[model samples]
Target: MFTSPFQDYVIDAAQRTVLFWDVMRARGNQYVEHTAQDAPHVLSYDFEPVMAGTDLPSPVNYGLVRIEPPKGVKVDEAKRPFVIIDPRAGHGPGIGGFKADSEIGVAMNAGHPCYFVGFLPDPVPGQTIEDIMKAEVAFIEKVAELHPDASGKPTIVGNCQAGWAAMMLASYRPDLCGPIIVAGSPLSYWAGVHGKNPMRYTGGLLGGTWLTALTGDLGAGKFDGAWLVSNFEGMNPANTHWSKKYNVYKNVDTESERFLGFEKWWSGHILLNAEEMQWIVDNLFVGNRLPTAEVETTDGVRLDFRNIRSPIICFCSHGDDITPPQQALGWILDLYADVQDIRACGQTIVYAVHPSVGHLGIFVSGGVAKKEHREFASNIDLIDCLPPGLYEAVLTEKTEDTPDADLVATDYIARFETRTLEDIRALGTNSEEDERRFATAARVSDVNKGLYQTFAQPWVKTLITEEQADLMMKIHPARLEYTMFSDKNPVMGVVKSMAKIVRSNRKPVERDNPFLVAQEQMSDMIIRSLDNYRDMRDNAIEALFLSIYANPLLQATVGLSADEKPPRARPGRSPEHIELVKRKVEDLKARISHGGVREACIRAMIYIGQPDSAADERRFEFIRSLRKGVPGELEAFKLTVREQFFMLLIDESAAIAALPDLLKGHADEIEQGIAFVRQVASTGGEPSDAVKERLSEIEKVFNTALCTKR
Candidate 1:
């Protein structure tokens, strides 16, 4: 093939320039963490050594930093102590509290005492997850002891892997956890969108747990965590290859430091015990037994998620392909038959799903950290104040034009509605077919693990030594940047000197620069190319696996082996308990007939959704007008209504069966309530649609029961 002289010259120049750039970046990555890490004095970070009863338990260290809260945000004396646990999947600690308005910063600004859960770089000779759990409990207990006068319990904020870890701790050690908030944690691991969320199918496609064991063996008994973090990044080829790098290249003047900074942490992954990785994959990914009370600790202690007493708040986003809302909330469907089951378990689980925020947004986004995280920290008590049931989490943005929150130029109040088990299942739309596949994957993993250990174990143990293994962990392409760029290399000094020169000029592209605009467009184009390459690679792998696995006979067998089935209500339970429950339901039903919550809710819905042409456009005026005598009374009313509602749910099997007959008398009242809701809404359209839907569902249930009983 003949090439033009101009084209040949261009290709040669580009190759040389790319090679030089790689050399410089390889050196700069040693100390920077964010892609845009320009040194600013606004934040200071330190990972003070964690005191283990013995030598460093793991290669990880933990520490706390004092954040100087910016002006105007008040610190509340009565707030509970805040402890933020950043995910140690691939990155280093401190991102949870990386900025001044971060989770740690928000907690501190709110005047609550705060703590951080951190780790060292190396694990003890044989550190296990069980040991890590013991250390975290000890740390939290010490914080509680330090703050004897703090109101309520300590609020534990867990980000990503830390989020699931916190949930495990809360389930087993509820006394130690105050209120648990899991940000971007995927509990219902087996569930997700097939096309969009292909990551979860990894174990099945790889022929189960053999790869994990092989990788562990390859790493000489200690599994490299960089591999796992890479899997996370690999899930988003677009983000990892194109967007992330293009973001830095286009905004090179501002993004250079940030890119290096984030890469530093992302590349600085620690290792996990072979047992730890195996268990997480078997019990979490393939088996998905955690939420359904199937996980057992190493010591035979079963981990029952239902044991947790704290009001659980789940923060996830639709844009988070890694941990979609379906994956976050689907556990509810796996665990319970209905909303009543949640209440009966005495659990309050509230979930918030963002319209477009990504998984990391749950933790790293400044807007999220300031608003949702802040509101959660501030009103945790209010959430606890809610009756024992499921609810949605919402956050309303403050606007500039309106003195009142109604007129505030807010995008939308950030509020998440409490969802039902049915509501959760509705998101993923998974049927028995999907559940069976995960079950088969779990069984296959078991068989492969047993076979591998029997045939490959002796050889694997003797073939690789510690030194060879350690080098492999550091040099794994996933961590190539971190291992090569440290200051220990004399070559880094040259790169540092160049960086200093770049920092001196400190010129970013002007908002109006045409060249800058073109550069950004080009960067985006490169990013898209990378993303498409990734998409093609993933599709190819999936297609290959599908062709191998798609046998009607084999799939049927797998389905038969799946553990999912219908739930059974207990037989012949105590009559005394049943009788007492019946009476409470009756009393609560009467209370609701005269109360303000349903009425207030319906009216509020109408006023907000339907704008009235003739009337003043305010949602709470009707409720506010009724607020004169309710000043101290709103709390009293809320408590009374909440208590009665839950009480009815707790004791009303008989009432539930007879609901239609019961609703016969309240039919007029229910309609009146609906009509009142319609009047309060704006005139353009139906305002109280959700509330109406709720009422309609209730009516249908009653109508069905009435038909059968009569």
Candidate 2:
């Protein structure tokens, strides 16, 4: 180990040199590639290219159109067309169909006709965001026209920023949409877990839209999306600076091709017009407008999340730092007082949060795309079928067999429960005062933004030029990796060749190696030091800024902002189909007390419950969301998991009641697990029939075995 330490210093120094040399070599190699492949893919939305001859419908051509069709995707005319809208936040489109186990791939595999919503760098003449939205509507209409036999409407999938954009489109034209599956969207800007995801707070800390206006001016009326991508990478300095590069370097032999492919797309950062960026910041990030119905497009048209009739299925992740569960969900709190308000509006909003997936994984991770996106695509109808309500989606991936032998295999389950506004509220603990304060912030932002535009924008724009604008855009940190590494240059070709050789010759040390262990230890120490600095920096900023901005006196100066509050609940339950669900829960509880597999099964089925007794009061809130064009049969779906579960187990009670405890001696633990199950059931929006049936059978065995003993 002593010799190893001496050897490690030498190796580390050598590695550092190699790393620096590689960067230079890579840059030289990129010069060659960039010169050679500097050509952009001139987009044409007019022609659909066929890579392979297939029986599936011909793909639509977005020409420079921004959309990609899966190579062998086939469509089922009987099902709704699946239109996946790609985010133009920075990178190009096609991530939706980039893999066979993707959102588009799954939709096509399920026999649903699919389409992509893409765009070009240059707008079509005078095209604006509203124009793009109209184009989306047109694409949906075209798909719908093609599938006249489809009983259901097209289910639209939108990822990240596109999710909110798609939601905006749906709100504008509810008739054209079916279900909107929003993956990793930050609809609720202020709704974040403390101590993490402080990016939203950045604008607030930066003193609002001043920088945005300045950046727009600097870009000569165009806000390069590269900056946005850079910001995303900047949030995770470790991942950006070391982990990412190290992962590729350590696994270069395998990672090179994958890295190149991803970087090709990732580096293809797009540009947004100043008008659009300004709107996004002033309204979304700063104003908090969509949920509040206070936004208007440049054309003077109003924006209202409540106007849409479709159901919205929001898919976010707890581990997703970019668009955390709170950001994805907080808009509900921003928009409505309770779920009853949602029901009164006849909307259906369903949200599913993964326990631990990161932001990109939500859309690109094959497992997630296959299971979550696949199930969501398959059961758009079932989700649409759910009665108007707030639902939590819980997916149970079918495994082969457990070591415990208590379960069966080969299943994909979608469990749903009807929820209320209060239940949705229960997810967080933000008080009414906090919300009021946020509202005040929103109003202040509007005034600040308006003042800047009226007084400062013209001078800023005149001072910046188009050439400088283009130069600035090209060099943005986000685009640097791509622009710097292409195969177009001559020098890069030689270095690329050498790099490949070196990569092939590389072999990592053993996990237990002293050097490897020391490397980890040292890297961790650096990371810890950096984290401390980061905490200190962030706390200093927050403390200084809060004293300056988030103030009671300033709030008082803002004035009368509380008058425009979200809708209030109608007090008690309105006696919708809720009573039936309640009765089912009570019955299921009783059935479980009786022993036997059949009885247990009956108990499981009979007890399927609506988690919130207040569901009926909030019916309007969900109904309104559903009507906004979210997919599924909104009126016919079950509201509670208890109801859904009871429906599953009760009928098969007799057969199961005859057997031993299916959960075995873990009956108490199993029974005690009901709280989580109830929560899962409550939030799980809709289950596919396969899952529903499996739960019934499990209950059957559970009922008969446990009942006889009792």
lDDT tens digits by residue: candidate 1, 532-586: 7877877776565455444546655544422335221112224674576578666
Q: Give the number of the best model, judged by TM-score.
A: 1
lDDT of 2: 0.61
Q: For every model in order, what is the number of clashing pairs?
A: 55, 117
How close is every model to the real structure, measured as TM-score?
0.74, 0.72
**Per-residue C-alpha lDDT of model 2 across residues 585-625, encoded as one tens digit per residue:** 56755544344322332234334332232222122222333
Residue 655 local lDDT, model 1: 28
Off by over 4 Å in 2: 1-74, 124-126, 297-302, 399-410, 447-451, 481-494, 497-508, 560-710
Error of 2 at 471 (Å): 2.3
Q: Kindly give the stretch of ten consecutive residues in candidate 1 with the minimal lDDT sum.
A: 608-617
